[model samples]
Target: MRKLVAFEHMTVDGYAASAEGLGFEFTWRAYSEELSAYGDEHIRADVDTALYGRATYLGMRDYWSAVPDDPAASQHEQVHAEWVNGVEKIVFSTTLESAGWTNARVIGSDVEAQVRALKAGPGGTMQIYASPKLVHSFVGLGLIDEFRIVLHPGTLGAGTPLFPDKSALDLDLVESKAFASGAVYLRYRVA
Candidate 1:
């Protein structure tokens, strides 16, 4: 069975994004390093698909698809662009008519069932990035297998939290790495 991995950046205070959804203040400079570790080679070897929410998919598709190939492009950006454009992406949205990115599709049916079916299918692993709402839903369904969280040092007093409502989740720490920038990468498996 393929595993479902949730990857996100969260502040020390647990906010993933601002209330207005304008900024991802939880993101730190070390995030680039963490992301770069999942370059084309790693993604091609491990990740077979991507699951994203409407808002995240739209924003990422627009930005990554429009990025030009220039000398100024950072290695992480170039690798990310390649991975985003090459991998298969499923956008779960109720209002989206169509997806703009290549190898991307819009799913409008039962989210949890579809995701479970996808995990049961023959594949490597499906990765979900920066979709806190979807993550919470999946967590409730006990569909997510692993969580790869990049925790920044700063705190947002009030904003959109990583977890939605109060819920009990028993997790076992799989691995952890701390960077010089006070950003820690923590990997946990659902226990």
Candidate 2:
């Protein structure tokens, strides 16, 4: 079966975004390089489908779509923009009327079941990116196979946490890498 990978950049304090639902404060050294390489080698190579919540999807769509034309975009950023725009995007949102981007679809019903069905279907892999609420929901359903966390070296005292509820989880470390900027890339398989 194909794996369902959840990728997110999180603070040491476990918050994915700030209290106001903005994620600007979360910074990673060589983030564009890391993200672009991950997208090309792991995400784009293995997974053709992306799942997101409304807020994250919109935020990502706006940013990724504009990177190509942005004068300040780096070489890595431009590549990521192309890769993201080419892939299939599935947005799970109850309030979204329609998705404006190409290859984007709004899924408003039976999200868990649909995700399971997609995983069971014929595909290489599926990725869920930066959707904390959806990630927690999938965790409750025991759906995620692996988690790739880019742990940046910062602490937001109060913000939207990565895992909101108190639940016991056993994870086996598959791999780990420490960057020069104090960021650690940890890969864990649900055990």
TM-score, structure 2 vs. true? 0.90
lDDT of 2 by residue, 4-63 (tens): 988878888888777663664576443656554654676447778888989899999998
TM-scores for candidates 1 onward, in order: 0.89, 0.90
User: Looking at candidate 2, what is the lDDT of residue 167?
Assistant: 53
Show pairs that collide, candidate 2. Answer: none
Alpha-carbon RMSD, each predicted model: 2.3, 2.1
lDDT of 1 by residue, 50-109 (tens): 888888888888888866566677867786788788889999899998987899999888
How does model 2 fare in lDDT? 0.81
> What TM value does model 1 have?
0.89
Question: Against the unseen true structure, what C-alpha lDDT does each candidate score?
Answer: 0.79, 0.81
Best by lDDT: 2
Model 2 misplaced stretches (Cα beyond 4 Å): 28-44
lDDT of 1 at 25: 44
